[model samples]
Target: MKPLLLIILYCAAVTLPLLASWLVGGPPRPFRHELASGLGILAFSMILMEFVLSGRFKKISTGIGMDVTMRVHQMMARTALIFAMLHPFLYRGTASGGQRPWDPTRQLTITTDFYDLSSGITAFLLLPCLVLLAVGRTKLDYKYETWRLMHGIGATLIAALLLHHTVYAGRYGSQPVMTWLWLVMTGLAIVSLIYVYLVAPLRETARPWRVTSVTRLTPGQWEVTVAPEKHPGLDFKAGQFVWLNVGHSAFSLKENPFSICSAPAAGSKISFMIKELGDFTRTVGQIKPGTIAYLDGPYGSLTVDGRNEPGIALIAGGVGIAPLLGILRELRQTGDPRKVKLIYGNRTDNQIAFRDELDEEDVTYVVSEPTAAWQGEKGFIDPALIDRVFSPLEIKEWLFVMCGPGIMMDIVEDHLITRGTPSRHILSERFDYD
Candidate 1:
């Protein structure tokens, strides 16, 4: 459905722009150039919408479509950036030219009249686009919030400048009807960006949650609880995640989605047990109690959304147990009679962060290492161990929710695949780095 919508929108945007240019007596070169740019922008928008609508709902771990979609979006954005920058450069010496690219260097030593002011101002925004592409993925040392804000501002500046230039100087966009169409298309892109930024954050703030307590769960792990002050905002089913913002300081800029660890109806605070693995997680320990935190959704398709199988089997490793805890707590709250078996792995018994919580829950624990007086299942979870525990008949009727280390999920997925389990039957999530 999303692909169909994208195709329709792309054709309309391209055809309308070309027809409008022809009707306005626009030159052949400018019309062809602007049409190409419009198509690129349309392609970029379609890829973005497709990811938002369908990428998150996919059950399989890997697919060719997912890879292609990501690649298309990235390439189209780069292409649009180049074309936008070059549009003014081609019109440098023309009477309609506003600013020259070389104006900045010339103004360094003395006053200049050779300035094409409009194009130069537009080119200034190119700096941000180049920087953002250079630091793409936020994989560098910069903070996530800082990078996101800068990237957003840069993209906005470019779009605004491009829109202004096209309206005033573009030959195709000079006529009233053509100008309105150009403005409308650009407006949609800006609106989409606003939805991604301003609108989404505002929606998140409406969720009811206040910081209750923070405790150290492991060497660098903190378990923070956010209970409702008055009434619960919404109950989260197991296997769903909420987008969280710590305080107003970085609220708008930094919204990291973390899986809920407590049941939605526990009458207690919602909890998130996170390891200090990154810059954002590291600062969570300093979060004071009574601080207001905004939560945006209980999103994701991994939850047991009523698949009437024989039972549910859950697997987790280390901090990945957060989502599994949500499912278990939810099951207990709803009085679900389905038998649930959990196989959780960790480096050692001591590092099993929520030991007390797991022991209290109606689930099995598979600890990898136990030094003294250890009596639980030992060693890594492999295909042989799973086969020994459950028969083929039992496996067929069981719904598997596997989360944790990516490698472990891969091994379990492969084992299930070998046993002829459909990929849709097994659900997993991992912020894995390739």
Candidate 2:
């Protein structure tokens, strides 16, 4: 279905303008050309975003699936950039191939035309920015904040340049139908981009949460809660996260995404149970409240609504429990009666973030390292434990949502697949960001 849609969209993008012009009985007008280019660029840009943006597609795609999608999006972005570069080149104010309207590529090549040069320079600049971003993301391992700023600015510049190129060269502003379509589509794309980049980041900056408290649960483990400045309702679903601006102010581009352990109903307040995992996250404990902070999120679709299963099975290892807490809190609020079984793994009972909270849920604790008088399920979540707890019917009907370390989710997924459970039934979220 998706492949068919892609083909149809591509065909329409390439042929629709020519067909419309032919119908109008003349050379393809600038208005028609502009509208065509605008729509084509918009469609292609959306496809490109899905691969780069760390969101639903990243979570859903099984390993090799992401690789394929990324490659395709990369190629499409490069191609679309070329078309944007050539918008003025091929379509603007010129006679081509004996004035034949059908000759699409008559003036396609780059030349000394100023408008064409402007468009070409803009495209050339924008394309390399995207390339650098992709390279920095995949190969160079650039700083997240740096890449984010450059990417936002670069994208905005490209959009502006393209709009300028289209208006001046394609002349859509003169035709009512073409003008309206161009305006609407351009507005929509700009709105989406702004929402994703500008508005979203600003909202995060306005969050009044200050780090009022920070507690170290154990070695390499900590929990931090920010006190709300006032009664600002932060409505967020479970299994969603808010980006945290630690050290620097929220206005800065250096924010990290973290899941809220507390439910949304908690209102005014949120808690993030985190482990001292990395360089940026390790500093999560030192952040002082009364300082500005930003939270841009509540993103992800690992909720219960989409599942057709009878019940849910939640598997959490260490800090991966963050999103699960959101889910569990949501379940508690709604008075959901669906049977839920949570298998939480930790080094020991003391190392667990929300030990008491897990006990309240329909959950079992697995302690990897036992100290003193403690006896419960131990070791990693192996297949034997899974078989012992869930029957064949239950396995088939139950929805498995796992969020934790990559290896843990991988093992659990493989085990579920080894049984009769289909791949779709088992869902996992990656807590690790590259």
Best by lDDT: 1
Across 65-140, the per-residue lDDT of candidate 2 in tens digits comes to 3323445555566666655555444445544332235554333322344764486366556666675575557455
Q: Supply candidate 1's per-residue lDDT for 188.
A: 71
Q: Compose the digit string of candidate 1's lDDT tens values, residues 4-62.
A: 56556545654666566666653234444455435433432332332232222232112
lDDT of each: 0.64, 0.62
List TM-scores for all candidates, in order.
Answer: 0.70, 0.68
Over 4 Å off in model 1, which ranges?
1-138, 161-178, 195-208, 249-254, 360-381, 432-434
